[model samples]
Target: MLHTDAPGNTRQNGRWSSIVLIVKMLLTVAWRNLLRNRRRSVIVFISIVVGITAVMFNDGLSIGMISQMLENSIGSHVSHIQIHAKGFNDNRVIQNNMATPSEVENVLRDTPGIAHWSPRVVSFGLLSSALNSSGGVIVGVDPEREQDVTTIRRSIVEGSYLTGAPREVVIARRLADKLQVGLGDKVVGMASALSGDVGSDLFRVTGIFETVSSEFDKAYMFTSIDNARSMLELEDRVLEYAVIVRDINEVEDIAASLRSKLGDEYEVLTYIDLLPILVSQVDMYQSMMYVVYLIIALAMIFGIINTMLMSVFERIQEFGVLMAIGMRVRRIFLMVLLEAGMLGVLGTAVGLLLGSGLLLLFSHIGIDFSIFSEGLTSFGVGAVIYPRLTPDTILNVLIIIPLTTVLGAVYPAVRAMRLQPVAAIRYV
Candidate 1:
């Protein structure tokens, strides 16, 4: 019994060793076949390279552009989160001012993640210089604290930021242009008061600021919170609290905690909530990119199919000879599949390296769209965009390209495996 078992085990080992050798030889042949038609293989290789490179470049650009827009919006005035009276964001009415300022202020001060907070008075009103008049949103802010929360102070291009002095106003450069006013010019602001009566005040254009957004430039005017309260007849009350967090990524968690503390009367909103359109642009770009990936993959699939079919057809006689010499039929199928996969992997590797290099280079140097600054400014994106590489984008490239090529080779592989040895050998 021991002797019989030993012989059977030996035979099994020999059979496995032969199978390994055959597979190794088939792999070598598959690779050689690709080299045999170098022109076709190189052409297919270039196509895959171009497709992958294009995908990476597009993804990087879109991510960079949207990210800059979000940062610009937040830094301009949105901040990380905002605490507003229940109806204030939607209605912008003085009647919707925070009902209990002390309570809300206490909650914010106690909040662990809040880095800085500033009270604001917001209203829609008209600013008229003697030469012209433009309607815009008026925001009242604490000069010192607002500087801690927003970048408007730094964005003052032509004049100084607000000093919290009596009746001081800061207008956008574009708005200043529209009103035919400049620094030290006088302007009158008019708005509806909490008492349902029209409120008006005269202000000096102490500063002019130019932010990334042309729309924001033309649509907002800022002044001291004291002056704004006096103008709108909402003394010692505020409509919103603009907040900045120590870590922006933790904004949602902090906002949730604030909501629970402050209750339902006040709305605790993150930048994601306050700037939905800008935030949604990231998701929209990602969704649209999948369509782009599919188009590129489909193009590669057809290219791979055409190339593999040609390789299979040109080697039909050689395949017949292999089968006649006792090579298994399935080896032919695997060989073709292997060839296609090798082509894909080689192309994808070169493409990924090239694409990642481009992304890395541009990430530091940045791409300047300054020539089209007007169009980008309208969308609230800056002129210079620094490309970013995400793990998910890299993962997509690793998974899609090789799989597409392998799937495309199925038909050619099947045809090669189905060849009849005798008939194939007898062919001319």
Candidate 2:
């Protein structure tokens, strides 16, 4: 038993040692082959670098736009989540208002992830200045509490936010311009009161705000909660509760918790639900990225195949000599694959470094698309976008490079393996 075990162990060790030697030889040959044709190798490397850089830059831009859209939406008014009375979003009537705002506030205060919240009274109404009138959504909010949930206070470009004074209001700059109104100017608001009567009131424009979305700027206005209650005759009632979470990632979970706690009377919605157009835009961009990747992969595959095929043809005599000198057909195939693999490794490494460096540099300075500012602002995205590189993007690139290399080598490797030593050696 001892003798038999010794022989088996020796055979296994020899097999492993043979594998190690073959790998070392293949690597050495591969490295030499790549260096032999410097111009061809450089061309292939440049193609890979360009392809990778384009993909990374484009991906960063897309991500940046999406990030900015989300930030602007959250800062403008959407917050992370909103709790509204059932069917309130569909029909913005006084009847659909939240009756127990105090109870909702208590629940929000008790919630673990709730960072800040503000109760709002939302109403669609006709707003008019002395010279012009336009239809707009009137938002009533607590001066101090609203600051934590929205950036309305910070977005005030002129004058100041609602100071809790009776009849004080804030208008977006676009709306203010359309109405020909400015600071301390009076704007009349007309909306349906709880009694089904047309409630009208005069409010002094205390502030003018400018947000990313021009449409939002023109369609929304704000006033103190008390004044809104008086104008809409909604005593102590609110339309919704805007909530900001401590962590944006935890928004869905917190919304679920709030839904379960609040029961069926209230409907909790995340920004994704509230802003379906934005969600769709993000999804569309993500889908487009896959198509872009496919195109890039095809370009890379063709480039590699062309380079490897050329290398195989040029080294035909060498492969014939190696095979004639007792190297196996499988080894020849492996050598061809190794050469292609090495090229891919070197190119991809350099490309990744270059792309990552560019992304890092641009992330700080940001890309200014001020030329398309009007179009971007219409979609709630800012002109200056800060590029972002996610872990997923890096992972995708890593996985694609090796797979592309292997795919590109298969035909060339197979061609090398099928070569008859005598025929290959005799060929001109």
Candidate 3:
């Protein structure tokens, strides 16, 4: 009220002398009002809590999703780098003219950045059971060297992985079901070339693997390179050579380096290039998260604005009394702003604490998608997605909540400043 002495009041003489007490007094009144109407305060509390909860849920799922994508990127699909026949992509066929595998292996071995290397031949064929059949792609890999290339070893659910020669095969459970084949069963696999010569081979189903991915589970078979070459009649030739670097995340750089060195003689692919589906998904998820965050921030802003506006209306009589003595409208504005600021700061503190506790609890127990097992699988997500809370969420919530509250309250605080002393007195 800018140092105004009201009646016998002598606590004020100048703006700075009275500013501290006026702020303190406004806060005391606002807090008391907040407590006086517990129901409305509870509604505000719930609005903020729900808003934070939505943020936590979306953020946690996105984290888990990205983590799974990274794991899958490293585990099964593309190793850090891939070397393929130059025209292998355009024709989408493996050629017999492969570089001496030993020469390539030696180079990869001596390469400082390369940590793990594996040779593989990819082929496509229709797998047939007695009553059913399905077309799927197959990979011929060295079982002993496969572990270093893929976590397929860990995903083996039944029977040992096929090793040695070309008679055994490992298949995902989905393909096994389509062909009505199981461990130890003989499944006839047929492969054809761009030329007319074709061959059908019998493979004993040696192992069954189960991963949460329906796409993988549905259509891939694993065998030794010898089997793949024997069926295709291409000896001493490989379709592609896959490699893992010291750091999987550096795949794009590694691929670029390989491409720069090798030129067009070979095609180098990275995990990023291998699974473009995840790249698109990651982008979409990030965009959606930002949208949800903005909506929640706006909701919090409105709650604070409504409360501050009501406080300004209720205090009109008191403000008028101060103004009648000598208080300036600008001073009244600052006092209201200070009160709104206090509420914003306090509310943010409480909201953050509540949200942190809830996030911690969810992180420990984990938000299970098991209840939506069928739904998640239909969408290609695993049934168990652990909730992860990063420092980013906490920082965003803390910053956004208070900042939005103060921004929203500014309008009401401005309106209070425009009120004249006589008009405000008659406003009640």
Score candidate 2 by lDDT: 0.88
Give stretches of model 1 more than 4 Å off: 1-25
- Alpha carbon deviation, residue 44, candidate 1 (Å): 1.5
Taking all chains together, each candidate's TM-score versus the true structure is 0.91, 0.94, 0.83
Best by TM-score: 2
Question: Lowest summed-lDDT stretch of 10 residues in model 1?
Answer: 4-13
The C-alpha stretches of model 2 lying farther than 4 A from their native spots are 1-13
Steric clash count of candidate 3: 0
Better of 1 and 2 by TM-score: 2
Residue 292 in candidate 2 has what lDDT?
86
Which whole-number lDDT from 0 to 100 does residue 23 have in model 1? 79
Worst 10 residues of 3 by lDDT: 89-98
Candidate 2 colliding pairs: none
What is the clash count for each candidate, in the order shown? 0, 0, 0
Q: Model 2 over residues 1-428: C-alpha lDDT tens digits?
A: 67876755674547889899899989999889989998998898788878888898888889888988988998899989999999887776888988888878889999999999999988898999999999998999999999988989999999998889999999999999999999999999999998899988999998999988887898889999888999888999999899999999998999999999898998899999999988898899989987888899898889889999999999898889998998999988888888878877877788788888888888999888899999988888878888888776777777787678768888999999999999988866
Off by over 4 Å in 3: 1-39, 110-115, 193-196, 246-248, 321-350, 353-365
Give the winner by lDDT: 1
Q: How far is candidate 3 from the true structure (C-alpha RMSD, Å)?
A: 4.5
Q: In model 2, where is the ten-residue run with the lowest total lDDT?
A: 4-13
